[model samples]
Target: MTDQPPTLPTSMRAGRILGPGHTVVVDVPVPTPGPGDVLIEVARAGICGTDLHILDGDYELARFPMTPGHEFAGVVVALGEGVRRSALGQRVTADPNLPCGLCPECQRGRANQCHDLAVVGVTRDGAFAPYVVVPERVVVPIGELSFAAGALVEPLACVVWGLERVRVRAGDHALVFGAGPMGCLLIQALKASGAARVAVVDLAPSRLALARSLGADLAVTPDELAALADVAPLGFELVVEATGVPSVLEGAVEHARPGGTVWVFGVAAGDAMARISPYTLFRRDLALMGTFAVNQTVPQAVALIQGGAVDVEPLVSHVLPIDAFAEGLRLAAHDPTRMKIQFSFGDASS
Candidate 1:
C-alpha cells in the first residue's frame, strides 16, 4: 500500500543557478513523480565539489536555471504509477547517476561512463529544494540512518567503487593525499579492507587531526611527509590523490613503490592538465587508474555504514537551511575550515 502525507504543497522554494556564478532562491512548482518514480521530501543535501564546478560553469553537463544537489537523503512521501519497489515514508538515499542502459559503456557493465547520462542534479532539478523526483530503481532504503549520515553515502560509494577497481594487497601500506572528507573515508575503508597502515597528508592541521581520529595510522602536513619513510622505506604500495589539485597528482607518482598503484579518485576540472612521467610508470611497474562516480555499489556503501565499518557523520562540519544557500555556497567554496556543507530541510519551509 502506498502511504503518503495527508497534504502536499503545490509550490516550494528552490535553489536555482540561472547562469555561471549566479544563484537565486525562487518559488517553483512542486514536482510530481512520473511512472516508476517517487517524490522525496529531502531531509538533508550536501554540497559537493562537483556542485562548485557547476556554479563556475566548469561542468559541461550542468543545465542552467537548474538546481544543483545530488548527495542527499530524504523520505519517500509519494509514489508514482508502477513504483511498487519504494514505499511512502521510506528513508532513502539515491544513486544520482542515471545511465542509459543502451549505451556501449553500460552494456559492458561500466555504466558510470554512459555516453548519454542524465544525472539527478546535473541534468535535472535536484534536492537543493525540499522535494525531488527520483526513479525508484536508484533509491536505496537507508533504514534508521541519520539523514546527515545518509547524505554521505554517495561519497562513500565513490570510494567503494574505487576499492573494487584497484587491487589492495593484504597488509599493504597506503598513502592518501588530502585529509578532507573523501580522504578520511579512504583511510577507514582501507583499514577495514586489511591494509596494515594508512597515512594521510593535508596542508590543514585540523583536517589531519580528524584523519588521525578516523583510524589513520599517521596524519601529517605536507612538510612532515619525511616521517612516512620510517613506515614505508621503499615507498607506499598504494597512493591515492583525493585533493583534485593537479600539482598534488603530478607529485603522487613519486611516492608509489615499485609495482605500487596510484588511484586518481578526485574530480579535477575537465580542462585541467597534469604532467607525469610515463617512463617512471613503466620502470616501476606501477598501475594508474581513475574511478568515476558510484556504479551499482549503493548497497555496499549502505552496508558499510550500517555495519559500523566506516563512520561518516563525523565528517560533516557545516549545516544550514535552504534560505542561507548563498552563504553556504560562499563557505563551501572559500571556507578553509569547512569539511562538508549540508542544507537541512525540516518541512520545505523558508
Candidate 2:
C-alpha cells in the first residue's frame, strides 16, 4: 500500500476508555505517520492490566479518550518521507515507549528513564485501532514469527528488563508470586537464566497450570503453599512479586529467605499501601526494589523468543476479532480463567 492509496475511513473501531469508564467499541480516526514515522496495519494486539487502569483513570500518567493497547504486532503499510529503516509489508512489533535519544537519560545510557518518553496507548493513540503511526526506530522486525507471538514481545521485553535488574545467578531458587502473563514470562526467563527451581503461586488454577506448561518446576495455588512447607521450609533465594496486590507484596517479604532479593514488577494502584516490618528489612538484609517499563531489552527479548528459549503460545488463551474488542476487554477483566486475550484485524487463521 502506498502513502496516498484510496481514501480510507476517517474513523475505525477500537476498545477504549479503561478504568472508571466502561470500554466500548468506538470509532476513532485512522492515524497518519508524519516524517520519520511509519503507519502500521495492526494485525494482533494483546490486552494488558495496564489497559484496565487506563479505563479507570487510575494510571497516573495517562491521558483521557485514548485507545489503550500497547503490546501489538502489525505490518507496515506506509512510510513517511525520509524513513528508510522500514519498508512496506514488513511484519513487526514496536517498543511502545519511544525515548528521545538526545535526552539526559539517553546520554547516560538509561533511555528507559528519558524525560521525554512518548508511550503508545497511554499518552498517545495506540494499536487498538485499525491503524497506528509510530517512529521507525520503535518497530522491530519479527521475521517469520506469528503475529500473535510478535505481540508478546512487549511484555517479554519488560520481563527481560526486570530479570536484568535482579542479577539472577545459577542454582538460585526463585518464587514468583502470580502466574499471570508477566509471571509466566518471568518463570521462563528465570529457568533460561539457570535458576535451579522456579515455583509459581497464583489464585487461578488455569494460570498455575499454564505456568507449569511454561516450565515452572512447582506451581501451586496461593492456598496450597502451606502444604509445600515441607519442600521449601526456608523460602526461596529470590522472590518476584508480579501480582500488584498489597497483600501479595507483604507475602513476598514474609516468604523470602533471609538476604534474598524481592523484585516488584506489577503496578499497584495509587494510594494503595502495603505494611511491612522495617526491623525485618533492616536485620535480614533483604533487597526490595521496583522495576518500571522496559528499557533497551527488546532485542534481547526477541533473541530469546527466536532461539526457542521461551514458549509464549500457551499463555495466549484467547484470540478475538477486532470488532469484538469490548467483549475481549470484559472477558479479560472479569474471567479468572483467562490468561492472555488478543485482538486480531485480519483472518483468525493467519
Candidate 3:
C-alpha cells in the first residue's frame, strides 16, 4: 500500500476576509511547513492601523481574502528539513517582510527596498490563524519575553529603523506628531536616544496621557500646538511625524526649527501626498527624510526590550482571543482609549 501523507491539523480557526470589502471568522487548513520554513503556533498578534487599512481596501498592495495580521509572536512547533538553526518550542517573533536576498536592493544591503517584498498578512496569509508558516530567516528568537511583548518586536523594529535614520542627538528637542502606539513608541525611542525633551500631539486625550506616561515631556492636542509655538517660535529641533495624515506632515514642516530635521515615519495611504512650501524648504535649510520598514533593527529592538531599556507592557492596552480579531480591529480603529490591541491564542494557557 502507498504511504499516506502525514496527518496535520485538518482545520484551523482564523479570521478570514470574505471579499475585498468584508471580513469574518472562519475555519481554514493549517499550513504545512516546507523546506527552509518554520511553522509557528501564534500566541499573540498585534493589531495595527495598517491592518485596518487592509480591511478597508485602503492599502493598495493588499490581497483580498487574506488573513490579516503581521505583527506577531509565537512558539516554533515545527521546522522543515535543513532548518537546524532554530529548535522547536522556542519563543520567537516574526519579521513580516520577506525579501529575496538575491534582489538588487537586497544585494546592496537595502533589504527593505527589495523589489519582491512579500509582507505576511498583506501579500499572503499571515498570523491571524493559530498557525503560520514563515521562512527561517525572518524568525527571530525572543528567548523568555512574553508573547504580547514579543509581538511588538516587529513594530518596534520599524521604529528603531526610523530612529536610526533620523539620527537623533542628545539634548535635542523633538516634536512627535501623534500619540498613538507608534507615536508613543517613538517618544520612548527618542528619549532613549538622548533627546532632552519630547513633545507629542494628538487629538485623543487618553493617548496623550499614555504618551506622557511613556516619556513624552509634553502632550498637546492639535489646537494646542499653536499655543505651544508661542513657547518655541521656531518650533522644535527635530520633528517626527507619526501621524500618516498629509496635513500633519505639512504641520510638521511648519513646526520644525530652521535647520532642523523632520523624519516622516508614518505610512500614509498609497495616493496620499503631503504638500510643502518649496521656498520654505530652501530658506529654512530643513532636512526632510522618510523611513520605510526595518532593514536591520530587529535585534536592537529585541535587545532594548530584553535589557529593560524600553517598556512594551504599558503600550499593550488590550489582549483578546483570535476569534475576536474583528473586535480588536474595531477597537484599534475606533477606540481612542486603546493603544495596542493584541490577539491571544487559547485561554491564556498556551
TM-score to true structure, per model: 0.97, 0.94, 0.94
Residue lDDT tens for model 2, 1-350 = 33634555667887777446666677777777788899888888999998877776788768876787899988888888789889888988899998888989989988888888879999888988778888998889988888888989999999988888888889888999989889999999999998888998988888988898888888998778884455467777789999889989997887777888888888788879998888888888899988888888887888899999998877898988777877887887788778889988854225
Best by lDDT: 1
The TM-score measured for candidate 2 stands at 0.94
What's the CA error at residue 78 for candidate 3, in Å? 0.7
What does candidate 3's lDDT look like per residue over 213-247, in tens digits?
A: 88887899988876666546657889988878999
Ranking by lDDT: 1, 2, 3
In model 1, residue pairs whose N, Cα or C atoms come closer than 3 Å (at least 3 residues apart or on different chains), thus clashing, are: none
Report the candidate with higher lDDT, 1 versus 3.
1
Per-residue alpha-carbon lDDT of candidate 1 for residues 1-350, written as tens digits (9 for 90 to 100):
33345598889989888988999999999898888889999999999999999999999999888999999998999998888789878899999999999989999999999999999989999999989999988999999889999999999999999999986889899999988889999999998888889999998888998999999988888889899887788999999999899999999999999999999998899999999999999999999999998998888999999999999999999889889988889998897667998999985321
Please tell me which predicted candidate would have the highest TM-score against the true structure. 1
Q: How many clashes does the backbone of model 2 have?
A: 6
Pairs in steric clash, model 2: 18-55, 18-56, 19-55, 19-56, 20-55, 20-56
| lDDT minimum window of 10 residues, candidate 3 | 1-10
Q: Candidate 1: where is the Cα deviation over 4 Å?
A: 1-6, 347-350
Q: Quote the lDDT for 216 in model 1.
A: 91
